[model samples]
Target: MSGRQGAAISRDGTFDAFDLCARRATLEGIVDATTLPRMADGVADEGGLARVAWRIEGTSDALGRPALEIGLDGIVPLECQRCLAPFEGPVAQRTLLLLARDERELARLDGEAEHEVVLASVPLDALELVEDELLLTLPFAPRCERPECVGAATAAGAAEERTSAFGALAGLKPAPKNE
Candidate 1:
């Protein structure tokens, strides 16, 4: 497996979770946004690359169970829900996940601790992890905060004011009142 400055830990995007944690390994790479299929639905356009950098360090929680500290950061292109414009959203996340040997252990760890717990499964897909973290960090309804977007919003409101809700009814008039 490679370190921070080298190639990805694995070409297939999978890695041994326990082994990485034990070795305190770091994997950093740049992946085109288009490569992440699931993430495509959330992005406005498939025209940018995301910088994925992560590291797994060994740790022990209060329960003395094996744990891994994952630190991830990246930037993803997203469409502003308000203006329908594309923008860049930054992702920065850190999580401590307890390694559970089996489903029973996973349930037990989850019930006992506030930290997240995952099965210590081998060959975990690193890209999927990165994608998940990035997705979580994204805003539920992203809106561009730039001055241009603000101006666009103002223009939209003005356009709305020029049109009336009753405009469609203006063409039709009430029939002559019954005498």
Candidate 2:
């Protein structure tokens, strides 16, 4: 694939994960979800910007595996399952990604790897990485965060109907000893 610029450095250029890890590079920038199709599809409004910050740790983990620390922050417009209304949900995540040369290496490190293992590819696609992280952080059940929302109240009480079947059956049994 053709190379891109910005956090996603051109592959022909100096964008290899190995080099980045060696140099301990840090990239801090704002990426547009509007630019990432997969991310854009899930957003209620594709106009929001994603703030991504990543640092390649020169040092390896206990397993001697290269790792990158990434953080993301953005407001994702999504439909609230609670209220069935559109709301801005805060998105944030920070995780360490362990970089491996190939699937074999990744598999070897699976048990000992303290962080998520990823295949280290050339011309690292920073934008794709950012989008993937953001997509994973998306709220599984988007809902209005407000405590007083009617939807929240209804959902809270919805479980009240759940009762122990044995308890209900006991109530139905007459108090025979009362006679």
Candidate 3:
């Protein structure tokens, strides 16, 4: 593991995938959540600061294909869809990406469906890859699963106790048949 910690990787920095794999190099760093614009859009508030730690290593997959293993862990503030409240959610993900040498090879590997296949575009944007993985890990509809949140939702629902809009229509009866 390389000691390239504390925002060592710039947003535009690129890495040669082939060389990294050959050397089996590992890079790890920390990035501010605010720096990731796309990820900020998914969170509840952009004002709060969050730190995301990431690690990437170049190696070979079980099938002997060049690959990159990525790991990310962080906490992000998210809005609860159930109670409409803000809460902190944990994010952790690990993925193995197989690299294909060319477009033709990418298409062929994509059909396997057993592993994630990506084009080994020389000088790959490492920061962009980290951001992409973070976005993918976010919940589509974030909901606070805590017991307090659940209780609050139940209490609010009971307090409102709204009658159904079609309740009056249910009371109507069919008209008697004309003689």
Tell me, by TM-score, which candidate is best.
Answer: 3
In the range 1-179, model 1's lDDT, one tens digit per residue, is: 34552332567877676766665656655566556778778876754665556655556667666777767766777889877878887767898778887888889888976887778765667667667666777788889899888888899988887676567577587777898
Which residue runs does candidate 3 get wrong by more than 4 Å?
Answer: 1-11, 152-179
Q: Which stretches of candidate 2 lie over 4 Å from their true place?
A: 1-8, 11-14, 46-59, 62-64, 150-179
What TM-score would candidate 2 get against the native? 0.69
| Inter-residue clash pairs, candidate 1 | none
44-143: candidate 3 lDDT, tens digit per residue: 7743766789887888999888998988888878888887788888878998888989999999989988878778776777777888888888888889
Count clashing pairs, candidate 3: 0
Candidate 2 lDDT score relative to the true structure: 0.65
lDDT (CA) for every model shown? 0.71, 0.65, 0.78
Positional deviation of 34 in candidate 3, in angstroms? 2.7
Error of 3 at 110 (Å): 1.4
Error of 2 at 51 (Å): 5.6
**What C-alpha lDDT, on a 0 to 100 scale, does residue 68 get in candidate 1?**
70
